[model samples]
Target: MTKGSVRSANGRPHSTTGGRPPGRPAHADPSTTGGQMTTGTTATTPTGPAPLRRPQWVRVLLVMLRALLVQSLWFWVWVLVPAAVAIVLLDRFGDLDMSVVQFARYGGIWYPFALSFIGVGIQFTVHVANGLTRRSYIRAVLVTTLLIGLAYAVLMTAAMVVERAVYTANGWAPYTSGHSASLVAGAGSLFAATALAFTAGGVSGLLVGIAFYRGGALRGFLALPLTVSPAVVVMLLTDDVAAGRDWTFPATVSTVPLTAALCLALIAAAATAFHLLARSAPVSKGLATS
Candidate 1:
């Protein structure tokens, strides 16, 4: 075809320039760094197994389930062995008085510590890439976190029950009436505290992961105070190690119920922050790709 010819000599053009006609508007489809045209529109590609068979929300739920599974595996593989070893060692070798319930009481805080940093950030990137809205991803994460908290609470309560049975059979004392006044009492308190703290930690973790993923080091460090505030609130409510070792408002709200309420409120705030961060979530480069 001639340079200015509208039609080729044989009445057909030979060059295929990505479906674009010659002299097309530059603004219509700008060139990417890789020379690909931007679609500039949404494309719905379902994710998860059997994408054609399941609804999109069900896929979201499946992703949430996977998230829960990963968290549970981390708990059992990474957190459990060390915890059991420490419990046994402390009970036998260390002279300090101890109970398994005390360790179980603090298990909720570790959930966020495990999930909030590197893992969830990568998950956010993947979920977005796989055609999930940031809104949906955050919601799934929150739901999954709640389930993790509830499952751990149930597990801890069952462990307490078994511990009580063994202690009763062996004629040994477990704990003498503090937060855990009796075995049943301990289970109730631990279950409630664990569930609350786990949910709060999950929320805090979402905030931390999103912050670090978006802002790298500077914003992540700046977000520390806000991102960790939910866990701090949980610590304030449940931990009685020292009065002033960490931030606490026990002077104004000393009761467990009040403290729990405060923690939930903080978790809600963290969730809001998470939504804000994830709405504009960006894909990041990683070693795996390089």
Candidate 2:
């Protein structure tokens, strides 16, 4: 209890310096066991989520798919619904040369195409931050693009069919525009043409988005032909103007099967190119953080 002496657990006098305990080395670590040197080793738990398992990746894909599908829903509500209404109104007032709904075909291509750009440019960082891998995000985007395209095709083909029926009921001739004037040969041909064109748009948008995202301005500019070619091919093979222009291959591939095959080939190629580019593309710190 006096200077240089402290009461031990047994009430005996224990020697001390600055109230240090007896029989303890001055430099000894409290963390170590008796007479054992401490290395400060610890079992490290990962800071974020666990390494992404197969099931986790699948869940992530589903979540992303759901979000994208919701976006598509809004697009259809805002664009397709109003377009359909306008077409019916306009057709009632006067005689029209072509199916007004046919013009909505371009909407099918451009809307999803623009959305594909946003999927990569804006959504990738968010996806990663949410503890998902880029691979999973890319897969989700790809699947969503295809699904959106198919949905557009179904809706557009149905609209055209309805418009044709209305035209017939009114004792009028129905014609197609943007696509081949002869495109509405059958429901099968119409669906295939719309599906291929819409899907091509989605894939072309992906190609453009990845090019700009991964390669910066110069490279993206240089890659424009490659990035934009899918949409161009679809337009050339399917558009009425292109058909009117007398393109050589356009004439040959104007049939339903050839058009479908060509469009599918373009979509496949563009999607693959996007995947390859995006897998190794650098994430910009400023952009990601911003």
Clashing pairs in 1: none
Task: TM-score for candidate 1, please give it.
Answer: 0.65
Candidate 1 structure quality by residue, lDDT tens digits, 1-290? 54543554668764544455566544334444366654545466768577356655567877778756765777655555665676567757874233455464465566555675566766777776766677777767677777777887677666666655654565444443333324433456656766777777777877888888888889899989988888767765755421112123464535556766777778778878888878876677572243
Worst 10 residues of 1 by lDDT: 240-249
TM-score of each: 0.65, 0.71
lDDT of each: 0.64, 0.71
Model 2: CA > 4 A from native: 1-54, 175-183, 240-254
The parts of candidate 1 lying over 4 Å away from their true place are 1-55, 70-74, 77-96, 104-107, 176-186, 240-254, 285-290
Quote the lDDT for 251 in model 2.
Answer: 57
